[model samples]
Target: MHNINYVLISLLGGLIVPLQLAMINAFRHTSGATQIQSTFFLYVGGAIASLVIALFVDGSIKPPLYQHASWWMWLSGLLGSFYILCIFLAAPHIGATNTLLWVFLGQMIFATMIDSSGFLGMQIKKLDSLKLIGLGFIFIGGLIMIYSEYRHSSS
Candidate 1:
């Protein structure tokens, strides 16, 4: 069951990502929107889709907007916009594969640190030396990919 879930998760996310890239590329060519703008539009479209589902399927038209949230919590959209902007800008210059390597490495580094320390209310998982070294190796691999891209571009 765990393997099945993993396969399904991979299949769904893999399918969505290429579709997103195509949409981003099309938006870039058609609207001349900045990367940031395209990402915002993407989220906007997602929000619309969610609204339709909620209204027609669930009969609830809105999230509990009345729920409390910190300023930073509400600013997640802005943060995501910045991240997507970086992704679009980087992916064109560096190949998508290389860009993803950087993004994944960054995420791994931050997530591992947070999870290890129980930061931000995450359940603490003490990072043994083995895990730390393994993560370090992953980060090094990502750096190598970026370096390869740099070298290729320079040549």
Candidate 2:
């Protein structure tokens, strides 16, 4: 574990995320594919790359099938697929900045409720006032983006 440089790996992965997002939009336009289709291709490409690295660089042959995985893990994957599909379809049209704002706002709203856990049928921690204020700020920013888009489109 001490030999592993996790900080460097995380930094590289974080930097690549935005470049990958840009490529998703660019390839969608260039290849005449819908953004959702482009995103699916990108996910496939990423999976292949990750498999190669894990097999060669890490020299790991394989892990156990569904080792310690619960049904929730599979459900999470389905949720991720839908979330990615929605964002890819909407992001290009909204502009990345605006999309980011709206997505963040939505995430904050859901996250607050999830943290409270009453609505989701879970027993998670409750949110504080600070978190509520932060959620409010997120929505305010989203509204600003919407207003900006409305003004630009109308004019």
Candidate 3:
């Protein structure tokens, strides 16, 4: 069974995403920063916070074995930056709930693919009928959310 603590932590992480996006939006408005500038500041803050956490957890930041690292490993930071930029651009126009609904739906779909395929050295988890059903429900829910958001915005 999955650890309850980890599950709760994951849920908390999910909760934080929308709040973070909203805060970033507010920050941009208050600071009069462009989206790209705000994203840059966000990464700078994140890097400092991450470094502090690493130091606390590991006693020091140890260098990775660069020679053994795959080229794809370097793409994580770029991918994360792109994701943040997309969120920054999208949340204000779409509303956070609408943006997040689609984001969550996309994450679920792609994550399922990754798990099933065991891509990037992940442990293979066979995708079954139950998982497909769950994804279908999520997709339906996303459609409902889209409809609601459209009605709310238009009217």
Candidate 4:
């Protein structure tokens, strides 16, 4: 049951993504900010909020032991920036629903591979038939979303 609470919390995080994209899109339109500028501000705001939260939680914003960390761990910030920029570019053009559907599909596919392979020192979880079926369903849903968007745009 504790794990279920965590799952619900994660789901809440997922629910926020589209809203965040929409807000960012609105901010770009209203502020006349370029994609890069909006993304930069987004990260800046996130950094501030994260620092505040860290201080509140731990009583000090202490740095991690970076000396022991692998080089690839550093790629997270770059990848996150790229992802936000992509979302900023995509959400307005594709519609948030379509953009998120494709994004979620892609995430699930890659996450499954990561889980199965234990990439980045993550615990290995064997990919099973159920997981494949779940992926299949998500892929089918993405196709449906694409078709629906095409029909809506064509009409």
Candidate 5:
């Protein structure tokens, strides 16, 4: 329950995002496979590994509250599929740095909206000017990245 532990775990999770995308992009490129096909195996491998871990840790395949889960709870698979497909399609052309920069920026903007509105069962967290200014900084950074990429390509 300590804040330090939570932050460490969050840092680890954050560190994995770009690495995961890079691995996915590399796999797609080397295997000469379609995004859907590559993404399918990624899901399958994740499911298998998760199942193994769950069985060892919890000693059961089913969650305690599976019966009470809402239909929307199952949509993460669809969302993840689309996310992977987008990264796979975009990373090769734009480079992973630019792709992840824009992705993180979008996440910040939309997450601010989601948090402020308390959408989808999340707790309401009001956004302030500081948060808006932070978002502006992120947008400006992405614009600079895009302009740089454009100039490099045009040259």
Candidate 6:
């Protein structure tokens, strides 16, 4: 399944998110575009780019099997829309590092639950002490980032 390729691509996507968010925020400043307007254009651009890539990579486009899909599948984009909105609002106020620290912490906790419980068709994995320790470290690091930011702002 080209697991290594998937991992590399996923890591690259993760690394790009902060940079993209920062750039989009800059556009909000320079272009006088509101966050919602910027986000709308961002998704418009993404849709066009994705279509271009799919035309090459997919070879042939086919309709998705919507009959077999759950009702929630249609609503999934709402989550992304909310996340993008929050990223635009929070990153500017909190700074990217602090904003992403909390976001990553939330993602890690929910992802651990999803992985361990086999939620949404994922393979079940035991959540062991090592996993707990890793998550704990992440939580502590996020707290530290928040505290440091608060202290600096207060002074």
lDDT against the true structure, each candidate = 0.79, 0.75, 0.91, 0.91, 0.88, 0.89
Off by over 4 Å in 1: 1-7, 55-57, 62-67, 147-155
Q: State candidate 1's TM-score.
A: 0.77
TM-score per candidate = 0.77, 0.72, 0.95, 0.95, 0.88, 0.90
Worst 10 residues of 1 by lDDT: 62-71
Off by over 4 Å in 6: 1-5
The sequence of per-residue lDDT tens digits that candidate 5 reaches over residues 82-146 is: 98788777887888888888888888989999999999989999899999999999999999999
Clash number for each model: 0, 0, 0, 0, 0, 0
- What is the per-residue lDDT of model 3 for residues 77-106, given as tens digits with 9 covering 90 to 100? 889888999988988887898788888888
What is the C-alpha lDDT profile of model 4 across 111-138, one tens digit per residue?
9999999997889999999999999999
Candidate 3, residue 127: the lDDT equals 97
> How accurate locally is residue 104 in candidate 6, as Cα lDDT from 0 to 100?
87
- List the candidate numbers ranked by lDDT, top first: 3, 4, 6, 5, 1, 2
TM-score result, candidate 3: 0.95
Question: Which 10-residue span in candidate 5 carries the lowest summed lDDT?
Answer: 60-69
User: Where does candidate 2 clash, by residue pair?
Assistant: none
Q: After superposing candidate 5 on the true structure, give the runs of residues whose Cα lies further than 4 Å from its correct spot.
A: 63-66
Worst 10 residues of 4 by lDDT: 86-95
Structure candidate 5, residue pairs in collision: none
Assess the local accuracy of residue 86 in candidate 2 as a C-alpha lDDT between 0 and 100: 72
* lDDT of candidate model 1 versus the reference: 0.79
